[model samples]
Target: MTAMHHLTTPDGIRLAYADTGGTGRPLLALHGAFGRGRPFLSLADRLGPDWRIVAPDQRGHGRSDRAADYGREAFLADTATLVERLDLAPCVLVGHSLGGLNAFQLAARRPDLVRAFVVVDMAAELPPHDSDWLDGLPETYGSLDALRTEIEARVSLGEPLHFLEGAVETDQGWRLRWHPDDMREVKRQVFGEHWADWYASDQPALVLRGGASPIVPDDIARRMLDRPNTRLATIDDGTHDFYLTHRTRFHDAVAEFLTTL
Candidate 1:
């Protein structure tokens, strides 16, 4: 069965997600900072019938609760709670950007809950991409298309949105679902600490980077290769949003990685 719904977190916060029940290993897919899990529906479809996919809309995204103090730990804690609540056995966690960092943190803290990790288009350490003013962006828009056009036009020139997949329309507007306040806090937490220095996961981890993304430097990607059980790959014609911009190549990399596990 295919379903999209909401689940309450440890602290009673409601988080939204998409769940597809099937036969193989259980896979949890987390979206980027200002992202919703639905954007990954195409990926889940292409993965075939071998896997059950669970894609969660981060705490402040999609149809979930929009509360204050929504930061990295809140999202991570909520993910851990969902895993325990659903009892996703032999789970393989797949994540992108901010989601990648949460996956690493979860595996590091609760190693037994995770079998492996697919880190998509995110490095342990990423340089800033002029995302500072994103929080202050106005939520009010005259029209949905106008909002999307503005966002797409503005973000296309930036580092991450240059590679996003499809856009969705909402009652408020057609902009990305990410809550601005939460987004600001999420960025602060992600760049606040050096990832390599803080992350310690022994499970198999794959780091996929976008060949076209300027946010991740070659040196940083190279240094990430030094980690144990961690291999690296790059997707051409893709920026930070490789899964959406280059679906076939992205799925190939993930499918190949799953086979090894």
Candidate 2:
């Protein structure tokens, strides 16, 4: 756990973010659904002190207050606000999955705020899916073991622990901090082609895809690099969570991009 900070948006949503405190050049990182800013502290360590990493919990995840909606506009607004309020403009942006879409969308809409961006295991095209997968996910469990059991039984992730990583302990019992309905809404809005948004920004970009990802296919990953000033790298045998599982390789790729900038 590094230094934590909070921001209250114009519409009164309270957002949380983690700052790897230092005078290094700033880099704003965004996590996918069901994630928080705490994970980036380790990423800061890996990327070294040369880049000051700032990660937000986004609208309805982690310590951030839930908003009225989880649509594309809402997510992008929060990110732009964070970067501007924190004086992090012209900084490098990094995101994964849902966060990856947000990163590039923000860059597309506000290129002045982003000097460069990295999109990890996400593409402009996404197939629509239903929220039936979220049925019956309880918010609370009697204990960490209980929580683990339910998540293990119901949810599938790159790692089972990932879903549990954000679980919180409470006086009544253990519970997941994020609301299941919120996640479901986010997922519902995540689908559809975003090629226009993808090519909107001329900013330098890096696209990182897992070699074996089901979310991002080989052709789509290659298409992302079709944009000028964009670079593509695939992590061998990596999954969507390659940035976490294959951290060293992920860092090496990012570090190389940082040098280029």
Candidate 3:
């Protein structure tokens, strides 16, 4: 089971997180856009009892406070604050998509705060993409079932339930906990050429990419592997959200990498 917790940032945003209590090395897990920290609970469980895993909902998402700023600097600052406030420095940092980019940048900015890093299905230079589905999503649905049906039609068949992780019921109707505009802004800020940050630190890092993901193509993955002290693992038949789509394989790959650290 995971315990709920909150940490206030320097900017006064009350960020929410899930903690898998244990007396072992701390692993800071970060979720991608439109996601909270809850999905990592299963991965934390698979990591066994020896690892204390903490996954935080980034700003503007989940139960966390919304912020006006959604830039790279702000995201990195939030992670840094969370690490310092919780005394989780020198811990392993694991992130997916947006979170993955944040992890690499944070590790570069404060090497002392991160002992190792795992970036899942994100690359330094992301290809241009479309988020029209997210931007065009209806704010409210008549019922949760209706929302799920819509999501199933528009999103992935693999994890329709995962898309509903951040939904909540209200007097008005059932809707996502986050504002679509915030997510759109965040997506805008996250996509770009970021090889410099990826190469900023020589700390041990693992780059996990979906074999079929266009986000991190073969050439870019090879370039990412060119850096010293970095390793690459491909999850065959996995998409950009391979961490969720292939949980067991992702967990095993991460577990093996942790042992190397």
In angstroms, give how far residue 81 of model 3 lies from its true place: 1.0
Q: Model 3's lDDT to the true fold?
A: 0.87
Per-residue lDDT tens digits for candidate 3, residues 4-100, read 8998988888999988876878899998888888888776667788788888989998999999999999999999988888878888999989999
Q: Rate the local accuracy (lDDT) of all candidates.
A: 0.73, 0.84, 0.87
Q: What is the TM-score of each candidate against the true structure?
A: 0.88, 0.96, 0.95
Task: Summing lDDT over every window of 10 consecutive residues in candidate 2, give the lowest-scoring window.
Answer: 156-165
Model 2 residue 78 lDDT? Answer: 89
lDDT of 1 by residue, 1-261 (tens): 457787887687888778886675689988877777776656567777788788887776777777676666777788888788778855888888888888888888788888999888777776555565564566656675566566765574334442232234657655555656676777777774456532577788888878897655689877777778887888866777777768889888988888888
**Stretches of model 2 off by over 4 angstroms after superposition:** none
As a whole number from 0 to 100, the lDDT of residue 31 in candidate 2 is 83
Choose 1 or 3, whichever is better by TM-score: 3
Count of residue pairs whose backbone atoms collide, per candidate? 0, 0, 1
Worst 10 residues of 3 by lDDT: 154-163
Q: Model 3, stretches more than 4 Å misplaced?
A: 156-159
